[model samples]
Target chain A: MTAALMDGTAVARRSLDDTRTRVSAYRETTGRTPRLATVLVGDDPASHTYVRMKVNRCRQVGIDSLRRDLPAESTTAQVVATVDELVADESVDGILVQHPMPGHIDERAVFDAISRGKDVDGVTANAFLDMANGHEETFASCTPAGIVALLDAYDVPLSGKHVVVIGRSSILGKPAALMLLGRDATVTICHSKTRGLAQFVSEADIVVAAVGRPELIRGEWIKPGAVVIDAGYNEGNVGDVAFGPAAERARLITPVPGGVGPMTIAMLLAQTVSAAEQRES
Target chain B: MTAALMDGTAVARRSLDDTRTRVSAYRETTGRTPRLATVLVGDDPASHTYVRMKVNRCRQVGIDSLRRDLPAESTTAQVVATVDELVADESVDGILVQHPMPGHIDERAVFDAISRGKDVDGVTANAFLDMANGHEETFASCTPAGIVALLDAYDVPLSGKHVVVIGRSSILGKPAALMLLGRDATVTICHSKTRGLAQFVSEADIVVAAVGRPELIRGEWIKPGAVVIDAGYNEGNVGDVAFGPAAERARLITPVPGGVGPMTIAMLLAQTVSAAEQRES
Candidate 1:
């Protein structure tokens, strides 16, 4: 049986539309548009493209974008200083420090430098603690938050469901598991070190493949009628799930390009507006 | 087949002996005793007993104890102010605000007020994040750290093992699961909202019962040869697991009173000395 598609593109569009309205209302009330400051480091083409797309989304939602681009040779202290300035700047409602900021630079130090209130990207340790503790107002990592939004948009049940998240990165798998657990779903976190991974996947009522490996989660491992959310976007647009075969078994499945990608930016935009509204309160 | 006991009492004695050595060495080098400042809000008998026990351990290990007892009528702001003093005071090497403060006081606010470096009890959000991210130098919640130390002392291999943690409280279950996952164990976190709890428990290689309810994890649900770590401390010395029946099938098990209790105090003393050493460095 062919599975129904979880149309994240449509969901993200609706989210951004809501964000646009909020932005308009915020501007009317405070006489200032919500602004998101982004830090882009090095010359990675993909990173540049991602920042540009985010800035473009800011414009579409009636928000202002402040871009701080740094060279490949920039030190951790410089990036942290830039973030410190944004944290002190009352005009910047949200801050996003694009990840993978050169190998030599400490990414965590810079992420921690972002103010908790302005941490729209939700990369800070303080932000993570808030989310882990089930604080509804706390910002979450974009991809994980987007996955939750997508699930909620489709009215998928999370409570008491066994969710096997196939990754354990702090930004993606770990936070996703914590968020799912917070929603009362029984959550299992598996990583490269996990033994008998296929057996774990087979038992999951909801399977979330966040490992970046292309088609790492075999389609045959999916339980029939399970809800599959593939947060992976590997090279060549391939996902971690063997999409075709898994779609045949899954009750609902999210497609690669249109699935998690759009929802991520939508959450980012939504969170930026939320931060602005918070300032007024 | 009867399961072997994990012997937390013996292990804790060894650990405390080591802490005493460290405390002496730290004192010799720094010309000051390692100090643990504990804030006990209200006069709850249990909390007072716990604080007195911890202070006793501090003296046993050659560390100094500073006690701050506040009235039951204390507001959240007052509790936070008390913590703030300890955070700013250089003489206090570690700070611990006993849990379950007066219902009126915001426990989290007081926990957050402690400086991260001095949060020896590991109740702060910053410390939780550090533990979640597997930072080696960061402090961890005492009870959870004690459980890990017990497992290590018993030579229980954690890598690739399926660990089912029953509970989601910030201090115990959640951090314990994160620490196990850091050690390469595939971790599943289940709580009150979880469905089919028995099935999940039966599949685990290691079962950790941190839920305070006595005998909530039934003996029949335990997998044969599985390691059982019960962290529950309930009335009449009963634990979350049905110990007598569980020991019949388990490979290794920890007793309720003698198991997790002593190890907790040992970890607190060790962390206090560690904090003192950090100051010396």
Candidate 2:
């Protein structure tokens, strides 16, 4: 592959290192470590795994992680109450509520109850809109913000460039598109409803594939010199883009497992540290 | 013209009539008139004119208008203080802040201070995002929400349609695009930074011209049978689209003067009435 692989792992490590240093300083100054309340509902295997990774990462960065595991049958009221308690906890600097809650639970309502200042996961509607409005804030949706961080670290040009985001999800696709627009990029959001998605992708200077479907974006559809970021995590550990061929055509490409995954947790921890710092000051 | 003209005026009038009825009902139920606190910073003539239109409209609809006119040199803290008092006031059912506040004032800070329940203008970050997240709550930004209302009134199909929104302002273009995306339209947002704007406009099934540049979108660029919405207000009362040519090509188009302008005030009044109704009930 002639393309330069965008190394998300290395960048994430650097970010983690910086977060670790600041976290140490925060603990020393505040006399208490920053704590992240990780709330996972149900026994979904994937959710369990993600929560474990985030908790472990928090510990690695010298930040404390508080685990709140609820039963699969937890009601919406129970979830909201749990989040409300976390919001009231002065010791908790950040909160992450795992997604895909039980069918009976109302996800939005629970997320809405999280305190905006302590929303390190960027789940609150206020936080989401702030980022969308291009307002300066310490927190943003982890994945989208991480993707932007990757682009920034790699020095990918955003000003006036054409960015085709292949999703319209509130968390991932929508936020990412808005962030790019804030950077003055001409952004086009293509969802499943979009016609001729490939045609749009083929013309974009930067393509962000986030449709969740595994390998939905064929490599041939990528522009010859474009930068490709795959933010999808699907079955069999596959990404939205056909990475092998996409790597060949793209001037820069982010791999599935090592790319956006690590960056998300890193940013979450960093935001947690920031929230702690802001609170202490 | 062969194209069916989207009569924003008639639709807006209908909305206003409905809002008027609701305001009257709210006044009777609450034993007080539905009150809107209009906050205006500085002495800009245009801002004054717009505020006058809104206050007069509120009076016509049987709603009480409380004007809070601050000096041009008002500090951000002063503006925020005024808004907070209005937010806490039992009589104020809705809050409308005129735009283009003095350069020293932080507009976002003042807007955020308005109670979400009473945010009739929908300029608050929370309201902007609620619409973006497709959550059913209160209101949306007046202009964008008005555009959506017009589309719904005209029965313009959005499902799986290509909607190219030519602007990215948080209050206008960005929010409009997100609302369209929520409606299942594949949305693309282009701004001044977008290269070859005409190319994107030409391919769209629906084009929302919100660039604020007069006649920026030529008529020939509009796809045959497409729906065009011009949300631009430029000098001499012109719209962003070249109307004559655009109307000739598109199946539907909104006239500049009678189009988005009236609908904005209509939506604002409608939202104000809605806030009063919800508050009363």
**Per-residue error at A256 for model 1, in Å?**
1.1
Candidate 1's TM-score? 0.97
> What is the two-chain DockQ of model 1?
0.84
Going through the candidates in order, what fraction of the true interface contacts does each contain? 0.90, 0.84
Candidate 2: stretches off by over 4 Å:
A24-32, A41-43, A68-92, A100-117, A279-281, B1-4, B22-32, B73-81, B88-90
lDDT of 2 by residue, B124-169 (tens): 7778777887875968888988999999999999988999999888
Clashing pairs in 1: none
lDDT of 2 at A21: 98
Residue B111, candidate 2: Cα error in Å is: 2.6
Model 2 interface root-mean-square deviation: 1.3
- Residue A216's lDDT within candidate 2 is 94
